[model samples]
Target: MKVAALDIDGTLYPGALGLQLLQALTANGISDKSKSEDVFKVVEKYHFNEIDFQTMATSAYTLFAEAIAGISQAVMQCIARQVWQQERTKLFPFVPKLIDILNSQGYSLVLISGSPDEIVCCLAEEFGISKYQGSIFATHQGKYTGKVNLLSGSLGKKYSIFLQMIKDWRVNLEESLAIGDSITDTALLQ
Candidate 1:
């Protein structure tokens, strides 16, 4: 099968889903607002092109993971839905058109993001894309265990996931296309 590997942050949408989820958690008092300020600062730097994608992504992921270390699965899911509702309307005009074009061309769309699985699932559902991957947090007793899977499917882990996807899905590399806004997308693009 031919594939269209897609990135969500800055590719499909204007902002980061992880950040939106983090903000929602903090707003709901699940995480401390003071702790989130640093993550936001890094994001601001990223927005101004002051830092490369890798650095910004790493910093944001670290901060977000630390903040949501103990949240329950149910709570995270509820907040993820709320985030999706708010972010759905802010997608780039090109995204829908691009998806349609790719679909018509027989490219199987696959979303790979650095955001949490909950939010990634929401995005996949919104776009009707079945095959996707995102950060997988470790949990114990239905709560976050302060640990993330080594293969979280974004940033440093993206290439491995992309390779696995290619193998599993039997993707035709010559006929496939990849779109992303950062160095994180290098593996898929390459």
Candidate 2:
């Protein structure tokens, strides 16, 4: 079996899902009314503090994560579905055609994305794709516990998983193809 690993954000879609999620937050009133001004203020503060760009970005993401940490799994799933369904037209133009070609060629399709498993699964279902072979990372209950459970993402995406898939499906790695558009995906492809 030939395996094809594809990245969802920027690769399958025309843009990043993070931007879409931010848009969703704004649309759903999750964002603060002064979000833009507040972001600028935060940037200025960081600059004044001599914080590097990486540190500033990390700090911002950490705050965002903390804010959403309390969100329930069901809510996350709902938000994901709403965003994808409503914005499907914004997906990359060649995605569907590529998927069809790969599917017709008897290639095993694997979607490896940083997005949560629920969202990925929903998108796969929407596109008539079979069950995902990748792992999804998510938190259970209210506590993040700072640990990610491989439900699907970086941790779940490993050579070991690919090896297992090969054994289970009797596929040869030599014939497998891994595709991704981010540096994070290098490990899996390598």
Best by lDDT: 1
Candidate 1, residue 23: how far the Cα is off, in Å: 0.7
What's model 2's lDDT at 93? 85
**Top model number, TM-score:** 1
Q: For model 1, where is the 10-residue window of minimal lDDT? A: 147-156
User: Which lDDT tens digits does candidate 1 get at residues 74-172?
Assistant: 999999999999998899988888988999999998888987889989989988999888888788899887666643534556767877766767777
Give the residue spans of candidate 1 off by over 4 A.
Answer: 45-55, 150-156
Q: Could you list the CA RMSD of all candidates, in the order they appear?
A: 2.2, 5.2
Candidate 2 regions exceeding 4 Å error are 30-64, 133-138, 142-147, 150-167
Reference-based TM-score of each model: 0.89, 0.70
Clashing pairs in 1: none
Q: How close is candidate 2 to the true structure, as a TM-score?
A: 0.70
